[model samples]
Target: MTTGLLIVQILNGLQFGILLFLVAAGLTLVFGVMDFINLAHGVQYMLGAYLAVTFVGLTGSFVLGLVLALAAALVFGLALEFLVFRHLYERDHLDQVLATFGLILLLNQGVKMIWGAAPLSVPLPAFLTGNVALMDGILYPTYRFALIGSGLAVGALLWFIVEKTRTGMLLRAGASNAPMVSALGVDIRKLFMIVFAFGTMLAGFAGAMAAPILSVEPGMGDTVLILAFVVIVIGGIGSIRGAFVAALIVGLVDTLGRSFMNDLLRLFMSAPSARATGAALSSMLIYLLMAVVLFVRPEGLLPARGRT
Candidate 1:
């Protein structure tokens, strides 16, 4: 591939990775700290996009809609935590899985009923609707750049919160040993509530940010949920740094593999065969990478201090 195309692909990969990080960051925290299996977290992402669509439409301002949607998502996530998830916390993992899985189905259908099955789109803010050239004959969407920048800013903010703040200290402690933290009078329930709410907001923010580029529709979060799981598995559950690094790795591997597999393979095989194999192999790249990483470091790259 030419240099320009390669640069474009790399940018695309970073953008995709950023989105994954946003979702995985929250997922890993909830899973790592609370030790809760929230199969329905993806639903939160889907809800965010849908909420953005609704709010943006009503307010006719992208910034206002995004703010409103995030507020709503936080409220809804807390409500779910209060009414449903909190009780499941004391139960076994099986019960948590089953309950959350059921919530996934319920919410997916609920969205379908509320928003219809048709896909929706959010208009890009005018300022971000243009494209910036990487070089001659290559250009990237300004919005995607904004997405990447915003995601990185969030990552930094998250790092500060988790690494430099009292709340983050508690989160790390909770992840390391929730029972012990509770024994020390940390109010484990309140901590769990905070973690859950924060995670839901992160996932929702990812969805809202992605709405301008990705199709907004029913069950949109399911695929992302799976990817986010894979990300945490690779990044080391409970480690924000791991999530951020692994996300970029997964994003680059998947994007580059898909974009160049066919071209690379065509040198050694028939065009049609190359295309077939490339498509299949590209799809498997991230999982294969995960397997390789796990084989090398069972705890994952940059696992939380206690974990590694």
Candidate 2:
């Protein structure tokens, strides 16, 4: 690959890493703090895109759609928390999996029923359309650049919240040992709700930001959901810091692997064979990375609690 192509791929990786970080941030918190396995979390992302499309269509304004969609996502998430997830706090992980898996089915069908089966995309705001030149001949989309900026800004904000704030300290405590924190009488249930809702918004925001770039459709979140899981596994659940680092790692690995795999393989074999093998292997790269991490550190890279 040319130097320019390499630069573009790096930028692409960074942008994608930011999005993964956003999604995984919530997933890790939900898993870590509440000790709940929420397989349905990805649906929140799908709903965010669908809601944005509907609201934007109705209001004829992207900003309005975003605001309304965020509100709707929070409301729906809270409803789910109250109606279903709340009851499972005391249940086993298997039950949480079964219930949340059912939720995935419900949500996928729900989106199809409301939005149809066809893929969709929200129009980018006029100002976001177009590209910018960086190095010699490389050009990147402005909207994607915006996404990177926004994601990093949010990452910084989240870091501050999780690392420096009082609520963050409580969350860390809860992640490490929820029973102990509850024993202190902090209304652990309320803390759970706050974490749940905030995480939902983060995942939803990722969906909304991605809608303009990625295909928006029923079950779209399913793939991203798996990726989010990979992120948390690699990062170490309950640690926002871990999620951030692992996300960037996965993003860079996935993006760069896909971009360069064919070329790398071509160096050793036939072009056609290299193309086919590289494509399949590239797709598995992140999972392989996750598995390797698990092998080395079963609890994850930066586990939430005391060292095992």
TM-score of each: 0.98, 0.97
Task: Give the C-alpha miss distance for residue 194 in model 1, angstroms.
Answer: 0.9
For model 1 the local lDDT of residue 220 reads: 91
Best by TM-score: 1
TM-score of 2: 0.97
Q: Encode model 2's per-residue lDDT on 10-107: one tens digit a residue.
A: 99999889988999999999888888889988999888888888887888788888889889999999999999999998999999999999999999
RMSD of 2: 1.1
The superposed Cα distance between candidate 2 and the true structure at residue 124, in angstroms, equals 0.6
- Model 1 scores a TM of 0.98
How close to the true structure is residue 244 of candidate 2, measured as C-alpha lDDT? 91
Judge candidate 1 at residue 224 and give its lDDT: 93
Q: Largest lDDT belongs to which candidate?
A: 1
